[model samples]
Target: MKIKNIILLLCFITGFNTAFANEGWINILNEGGNNKGILCTPAIQKAIEKASKNGGGTIFFPAGNYLTGPITLKSNITIYLDAGSVLKFSENFDDYLPYVEMRYEGIMMKTFSPLLYAKDAENISIKGRGVIDGQGKAWWNEVYRIESAKGPIPETKYQKMWTEQNKGIVYSPYYQRTIDKKFFRPAFFQAQNCKNILIEGVTFQNSPFWTINPVFCENINITGITIFNPHSPNTDGINPSSCKNVHISNCHISVGDDCITIKSGRDEDGRKYGIPTENVTITNCTMLSGHGGVVIGSEMSGGIKKITISNCVFDGTDRGIRIKSARGRGGVVEDIRVDNVVMKNIKEEAFMMNLFYDKNTVEEPVSERTPIFRNIHISNVTGTNVNKAGTVLGISEMPVQNISFSNINIQATEGFTLNTTDNVEFHDAKITTTLGSSFKIENSNNLILDNVASMKPIANTALIKLTDVSNMMISNNFPMFATDVFIEANGAKTKGIFLKNNVFNNVKKVINKGAALNAGAVVE
Candidate 1:
């Protein structure tokens, strides 16, 4: 093709002027004839470097399968993949050698490079209707081998070890230890400390670790992407860690881990950085077959706030709207709102806030390491065929507070469970369960259950069970038919329980275990 004609064609294809178009289009195939059989890591890296030096342009990948290793992305560059293109990463672990500065499980360390990585860059993007396959089977097999050799993983062992190794420099408990960085796996796409990032219209598969990870980034916009990494370990779809102003929409994610997880950092590293992941919005996404549809950390020690999740669908996930943290990982998770969510076939709880993640049982004094969860509002959510409706398991030292749920409906095998929570309200909630009480409250205070109904009638079970609860107001609730008791309270701490205007039909008793005999307890 003539130079002028080729320039015009490139301009038309990229929808830009001739000068801007020709300068930006660096076709890798033209530079090095689509090296499908050989590893094209060096050639692609050269192309990116050349384009970046020539004032930042687009490195175009035409229709071919380019097998590569880790490729470091440059600033002011866009990786545009053509329709029939596939940038498949090499399976050889040695290719990702010479560990780079990255975060492994929220801990900052020198580790293997991700398939596509950028750090301290600006105006970077990966947009195309093409596929980026991580080819992560080898990585997954290695992890399995390690687990098989290391019998029954301890939950806090690694976190404790990492914290101990990096003590004084970080936080948590002070202990002397050393950590081996060999077990770190690479992510598919990770951009750290980048700004004005855009990722759109791409399909990702077989990630060794998290699919799309943006750490300490700002103004990230990810839209119209599809992530598929079924049955792969740690293949979280999108994990935005310590990022701000992130907007994710129109994405279809089905991964082995959480579909979309918001994080800051892990225990001490998180506290050291102390950068909260805030002002995020996720909408119009489809989540299928993951740990959680939208999760906010088992790793959020750096805090997370001011997030909104709306207009999403979760199908066949283990849980939906999961917020998990541990005792040592102390940070505030608040000001979150979830609305207009629909879920089906959830394997576990539809909504959960678990402060005791990983079975952490270390009894330490209440200090900066005590995690706090409060001010969460959920409305207009519906779920069917879930194993459990929800769980709010907070610690005794710091109870989860000021959570409200309205217009929510769920069908589950077990009902909602709240422990060590305070000032919670559930209004217009219809929870139907095949077994167990519709609501189980334990060691909680100042709860209001208004207009809540148990749709399915189960025999020999109370619709609501309370233990060591205080200052509870249960009003306008519709108890199921054949329920043995509408409300049952036990333990000496169960006091000030007021029940009024509740409809009890076919119930053997209104209050069981002589809970109404307590002082200041009224049932009318």
Candidate 2:
């Protein structure tokens, strides 16, 4: 069909965008932007350098408003954004001045340049129904004046004088603030060390930072996207650091932090780039007010394993399926799998696995920097109203191990907390708290609470509360029609607790040995 590709397919059938080259579509108004709302960044970087010099293609941005700046991308590229397009960007932070090799939140620095940047390119894509706006309210007001500045705060004019300047600026892994150019707010679509990747049906908005970041990428596929950065600080919605095969589906995030975060790099350059955000698969997503609706790591030092979160749906989120790490982040989050989720109005911990996220009280000695959470498996979950019905906080030098929770249900206001854990299990779980202990175990050991139940037991606590727990098994039960201590054994190293075949009418005291338990420590 070469008559100059049939007169550019009749100038795209008379709608006029003469850059149609067969197997590799392209328009940018036929490159060398002559119009269409100004700065089209040299006509979309000359149609991605003329389709990477004619070996790769698909660069169309048909319908309207585009004001661009930093856009690199290469190798087998694709950028189709049709339906009324609106690629807006450019709040002009010096148009992302010459800086490349990025990584930001997981260290590996070299600022700016990330309003759709790509590096170490490979097969890439960015399909669309179109609207990508990273206007991020004046770049989050320069991070709120570099976090309400205090002392020594020089360097502005967008830094860069061969940047190497600093006055401070750590900003929470617990403190220090006021430095510029190192970890600058850019990233509204980033890709590094790229591999086969794709982003589909877009709608991304307000960004300036963490709005679809994929560093050290591998085979990845994101689908039916729709992210809206509310409030804006940190604006995270789809972060994949040190990546591996990832497949996120049908998303509809609401961000301003964690509506999909899974990093594998942070401390000691993340164990010196040990590369680990492993095989992930998040499905049918729908999260609303961010800050954990699928979060992993308070920067997991290069180790987050086989992940899979399924049939998701969280609303008014503030934590749901969160796994955080700490203690110098030595890294080793293992086989995780959450399933059929559905949370609502959760304002905090509706399922959490923590490893002491740094208050760093200093009680050293666990080598390699210590940070290890193990074999996680959640199932048919449901949380409602929640304020806490979650927690497996480990760290008495490293404990969070083998965790399990099947057919779970939570309706919280405080309940479900296990500390410094070990092999934990809670099948057919049910927590419907309104106050205290609906399940609380501390300095844990092996435990199994099959058919675990609790409906609103807080009348003088104890629907299961054991401290310094030892190997325990509290079988099938339904407590809380009246339940007033259906098992309460405290400290004294709570020896081998047991209570087989449970169903104490409505339990009024099926075993209570508190006051530093002894007397063979709880068995009935």
Candidate 3:
């Protein structure tokens, strides 16, 4: 009987321990003096520190505006802002200039002002329907005013806020601000060298600079998040630099700059580190009024590889899916797949790869061989009011290989302009254009046109122009404007020109230098 009583006592202790471990609710408003209205500056931080010291738990921010600045997240913590809670940054820049180690603007300079920042923390999350607004009016206005005067150079430094002191020499901007440049850095949420981050169900708006930047992090998941910054200049959404295993889904992002950018580093500073950005997936998102729907790099010094984008919408953007890298950026961008997209009112080309952005005539442009964009499977793409149909500007030396376009319909102003590329297959690609030829190919080899058609050209030129090509074959093809069918290859080296199973109404024969072996086969 005594032993039975001892067991009952043990059961009671176990139940009490479990209850104590679960009930760790620490409210910031209750920790300090009666300063209500959701003041989370020092009060909430103190409560969080105290709770973390004891053990880790959820520190709740109830509904209302919580004015805070630079709240660092620690290990084993989950900050759940209850629906209707608004975490706003302090307007004063002095509060954010704590001097941290951060990478900004393709350079590793020092400054302050990331609303929520944490480094090397494990199992951290910023989840809820709350809002983290980086009151960026002051910073935005200053950047606008400076950009007007200086013209296209970044003028802010944001790395000093995280670390103790700044040691590296930053490239000086052309002009200086009257206020401090180091104190004016801007990022809403910047997490570095972290693991296992889950940021979901938040409305992030109006950042001073790039909205969400997570660098060198892993095992990250960002879902159901909306980042909106309608203001101009320096408003990029969610740039994951040098990270691994990232998944961004079910998000609505419409910013002023590039909607989502992937970067390893840029220029000499980025090359010094030599860490490539890899293995990222962005799916099920809607973009409005950004530079590009998904951009790879102009600042890709380290390298970028293995990225997949699926099930997205690009409405009224400059370019739909753009891969932009210059000469100084010596990296390889390969294995990129974009599938199942809908575009409306894209002002520029739906797909563009510019290997020579800022090429100079005097000096050879700083350019890597237009990186191989193969295995890029694009399907079920429907578009309206596109300016340019598509562009494949391969390097002057070697071609961009193994690119396939499947099941695409575009109402464009201009059609495909392909040059110096091979092994490009177009399956059921119908592009309606009002200017230029239906297709223009130059310095190319082994091009297969299967079920490719163009309608009623306005330029009164040939439907398809083949110049300086080799081993060309046209089979089962229809050209609407057969005014100049099969323009002669003046300097082209044709091994065997095969024209078979083709149906042309007004076009009977092509202008060719070689012999048409089977001319009377259809209408001799």
Candidate 4:
């Protein structure tokens, strides 16, 4: 089908009325207003059923506090909350009874219903200047209590144990077993297998799990949303899993986990489904106090492609632009472009691509489960007060390839580090570090450094260090007033290195080691 026809079909399927013609608007208070602090799930569900039966309309909630349990959304429906209104989820876990199909931490399984959920629907939206409070303190305390009892062995290990325990039940190696329903907290909003969805102008807070999660959906638009989940665990701002054609803009996110995360699936289940999240665009967003401003995967086994993130600001985040996956999760992540990003006070590396996430470092033979990262380009980025400039650590068997950076500036305590990567290039890059070498390359190949330099001179540190690297070209660089030792190469594998048309000043001796001193290897 053509794209326009597909969108029209989605609208028809979801009962979206672009004109908002003579459709009826039903108010829950008029239907049955229970102002006694009682459960309003039944009344709200009735109103929604009525609206859906009447060919879809708006279910309006005026200025009041409505306590409810899980609410399911229908197609062509809009849930509008006026200013000074709040939809507060009940704290009682029993309210969210009956399991629902949902993805938890990249694993798809049956669990408690999300606070607000929709499945197999189209053209649905939730828009308003109101608040949807998860009242997640109780759930957070419950999870913490369980973790305290389980002891500290890293969350992934515990998750793996749970996944193994339920192997017979879920019939998938990657599924997590919820020993008890109360222990598993649901997300605030989850939509699955839907299209033409819109979530705008809403304030979401204190989510039990991820704030806004959409799985296996398409054509989702989220804008002007504010999410604040402070000091909470696993409360990522927005996570779009196995989705396509997604656009997120003008959002302000501050959460305990990653602000915006793109995921496909996890482990065996992910490989089994073989769905990819593609054609995503995120722009003009402000992120604060999250694990990562924009994260690709720790659970991307299904693959991800054609993602663009631009014109974003990240402040006080643990990391910026982090892509992480382990060896066991085999997937391809490619064609990622990020530009015009500004970051300040990053707690860790400004840009990090780590293929070694799990603790197991043992070498294994190449298989279908080997992760691959390639064709990533980042440009026009600036960072200050960063702990580390960047790190690219790829696997030995399938090294990360074709990564490039241009017009980048970083001020940090340490510089860039590359390991087991190939075909990486840096152009017009300036790195200022307080300690350690400005650039460290190990077991990499085909590296091109053009017009790259360190911002200031530092004593007792080499400006660039290469070990076991080959096929490198260092040209047209300004190493003036930098470290005394301009470039140092160690290990016998260092060969095919050519440095030309570079300026060296202030009593610096170049080529400290390995590569033979020749006309082609070094030219002053």
* Strongest candidate by TM-score: 1
lDDT of 2 by residue, 322-355 (tens): 9988887788999999999999998988888888
TM-score of each: 0.90, 0.39, 0.82, 0.90
When superposed on Cα atoms, how far off is each prediction in RMSD? 4.8, 16.8, 5.9, 7.8
Candidate 3: TM-score? 0.82
Candidate 3 residues 1-524, lDDT tens each? 99999999999999999888758766656776122444357876776677678777777777877777678887767777778887777777777765566778666755674778888887888888988787778778765566466454553344233333554544323212422344446677888889988889998888878887887888889899999888667788888887888898998988889888888776666777767778889999998888888887777777787888889998988878887665555666677788888888888888876655545412344354223344455677877788887787666544666677778888888877777677777777777778776567776777776666765544445556666565566677666664445333344244444566776675644554424333322121
lDDT of 4 by residue, 1-524 (tens): 69999999988966756435535788888888453557799998899899999888888888878888999999988988889888889998778766677888777776668999999999888999988899999889878776666544444333454444445433233222334322467999999999999999989999999998999999999999999999999999999999999999999999989999999998887888889999999999999989999999988899999999999999999999999988888889999999999999999999999998875655789887898899999999999999999999998888889999999999999999999999999999998899888799999999999988788857767888888888999988876664588788887777788888777765377778764433344333
Between candidates 1 and 4, the one scoring higher on TM-score is 1
Model 1, 177-248: lDDT tens digits are: 224323668888899999999999999999999999999999999999999999999899999999999999
Cα lDDT for residue 343, candidate 3: 84
Candidate 1 runs further than 4 Å off: 1-22, 33-37, 150-181, 479-484, 505-508, 514-519
TM-score of 4: 0.90
Candidate 3 C-alpha error for residue 254, in Å: 0.9
**Backbone clash numbers for all candidates listed:** 0, 0, 17, 2
